[model samples]
Target: MVVNTGLYAFNVTCAHRQITPTVNSIYGDATPPNTPADFEIKVASPSFTRRFFRPQVSFYCDQHSPFKPLPLAQAYALLEWGMNWCIATHDHTRLLVHAAVLVKNNQAIIFPAAPGSGKSTLTAYLAMSGWNLYSDEMAIIDLESGFVSPLYRPVCLKNNSIDLVKQWFPESVFTSTWKDTHKGDVAHLKASSWKQYIQCKPTEIVAVIFPKFVANSDLKIYSLDQLQAFETLSKNAFNYGVLGNLGFKMVDKIIKRAALFEIEFGELCDVQAFLSEDIIR
Candidate 1:
């Protein structure tokens, strides 16, 4: 299948038959059949025996398998993650930051955080609540313009957040949860339709937020200086080291242009209020 995911077209072949429905549901008819794709990928059984016994699927990009085989139930998730891996690893035209990107009023803010930091939860909330979700896992910034582009992909919800989001937004579409993955229980939330995603243009990033979720605590915001923001963003980027001098210039441009902050919050509403009342203005 040639799936046009806004940012890139993927030519995906699935040996696991069930993934096709999920792909069609999320992507719709974004691309024509026989269209060219940027990345050629597959989710298939590792061996003939594995296809029948215990049933595991492995992700392949071209001929190379970057990750080990996973349970058959996780084939869709594997395909999504593998697509992200392909872009982050191969595409050097943009600066790929490990962040959740949300845009409002033609201005963008990127939340760069580590695993288990509630980034995806926050992204899922904001995206469903009217913010244009550029990406749940990557902030793809153009090297020259320093503007962020949207990736038509689902927000990955892990562990308890999956149920939390499902309960919070009953209208949202979510994939079946894959139990006991390396990231704990995992599900993907289709926060927006392809129509909405394709309407989003590459927008200038106005802020860099490093968010940490602390249970039952009040929202606390800390302003970060350029030096601090640069250091942290550099660490969060996938191609920072590979881009070298070009990377330095792009990071410098964003740091100089964007306001920087680190936010610790117990409630998603508080974060939303801060961004709307303070940052967006």
Candidate 2:
């Protein structure tokens, strides 16, 4: 089967048609029944029944192994993530930052942080509340328009956050947990709808936030100057260096248009309240 992720299309062939029900349900239609793309994926067998590994790749799984079983839902999450990496790493002419994006009132806010920085957790919380989730792992900025385009893919939720979000919004949809992976227990939240994917819009970014989850830390929002924001954003970007001078122009436009900040918090509620009162207002 093949899938098109809006930005790029992929062709995936799995040994078993019933390997991942969730993946099939969401991406089954994406299989290139007509068009063509350079990106493609081929799954040898059902992850539950096969022992597999690729060259230079360290992870492998088998049916009888003690490793925790990865549910079908989680399989789709893994697939999407791998595809994103492929696109970002190979397409080096655009600015691709590891960030989560949420839009309000036609304005977008980007949160760029390293792993374990509570970026995804906060994104999930705000998305479930009211914000439009653009993406959870990537913020794709258009060089010409100076606007951020939405990538409506799954939101990767990790470890304790999986259960925390479940309790917070019991009605929210989540993929099955893929236990014992590199990032501990992992799952994916389908935060944005399919309609958003089809009707994507370019949004002007109004704010850039770098979030850090500190236990017992008071909720603090500090202003970030344009120079600092530019440096930080460039470092977090996946393709800034690849774009060369064009990348510099894109980054300059973003910083000039957006207000930047660094937020430190331990509670999602406090962060949400601040965003509602300060940023959105």
Candidate 3:
């Protein structure tokens, strides 16, 4: 099956039949016929006997299997992760950052946070609240224009965040949680529809926010200097070293134009209020 996610087309062969419903639910009516896929991938049993024994699924991008075989239950999740890996590893035309891209009123902000920072949760909230979710996992920045483009993908929530998001937005569509993965209790939230994704265009980045979630704390916003922001962003980038001079120049340009800040907050609403009233205005 060819899953066309507006930004990239993935030709996926799923040997695990159970993974199909989750894929279909998340991406409905987005498939385009005869469209050449950007990556040819598959999620199948690692070995002949494994299919009948323990039942593990392996993600293969063409001839290479980037990840080890996971349990059959995580086939869809593995496929999603594999797709992200394919883009980050293969695509060099754009400067890709390991960040969540969210846009409002044509102003885009890239949240480049480490794991356990509640980045995904914040992204899910903003996306559901009305902000255009460009890409939940990556910021597709144009090297020349320094603008960020949207990718058709779901926001991945893990552990406690899964229930928190479900409680916040009960009507939102979510995939079945795959328990005991590398990232424990993981689920993917469909924050925006395909129509919203197609309407999104590359927009100039207005801010670079590094958010950290603190338990039961007031909003703390710290301004980051250009040098600090540049260094941190470079480290967070997937292909900074690979892109070399081009990547350096692109990061420099973005820092020059974008307001850089570190935000530590306990509540998503507080962060949203601060951004909407102060930064994005």
The candidate that achieves the highest TM-score relative to the unseen native structure: 3
- Candidate 2, residues 1-281, lDDT tens digits: the string is 55666666666554434446767555444434355754656443334334443211111222222123344424554565566767677766457888999988888999999999999899999888888888888898887887887875778889999999989988867777778666888887777666656655788888899999998988988999999999999998898878989888888888898889999999999998888788884
Please identify model 3 stretches exceeding 4 Å from their true place.
31-34
lDDT value for candidate 1?
0.93
Q: TM per model? A: 0.98, 0.84, 0.98
Cα lDDT computed for each candidate against the true fold: 0.93, 0.75, 0.93
What does the lDDT come to for candidate 2?
0.75
The segments of candidate 2 whose C-alpha lies over 4 angstroms from its true place after superposition are 16-18, 25-35, 45-77
Query: Listing every candidate in turn, what is its Cα RMSD in Å to the true structure after a full C-alpha superposition?
Result: 1.2, 5.3, 0.9
Clashes counted in candidate 3 amount to: 0
Q: Candidate 3 — which pairs collide?
A: none
lDDT per residue for candidate 1 within 1-281, as digits (tens), equals: 78888778888999877999998878874655355689999999999999999999999999999999999998988898899999999999889999999999999999999999999999999999999999999999999999999988899999999999999999888889989988999999999987798789999999999999999989999999999999999999999999999899999999999999999999999999999999996
Candidate 2 minimal-lDDT segment of 10 residues: 55-64
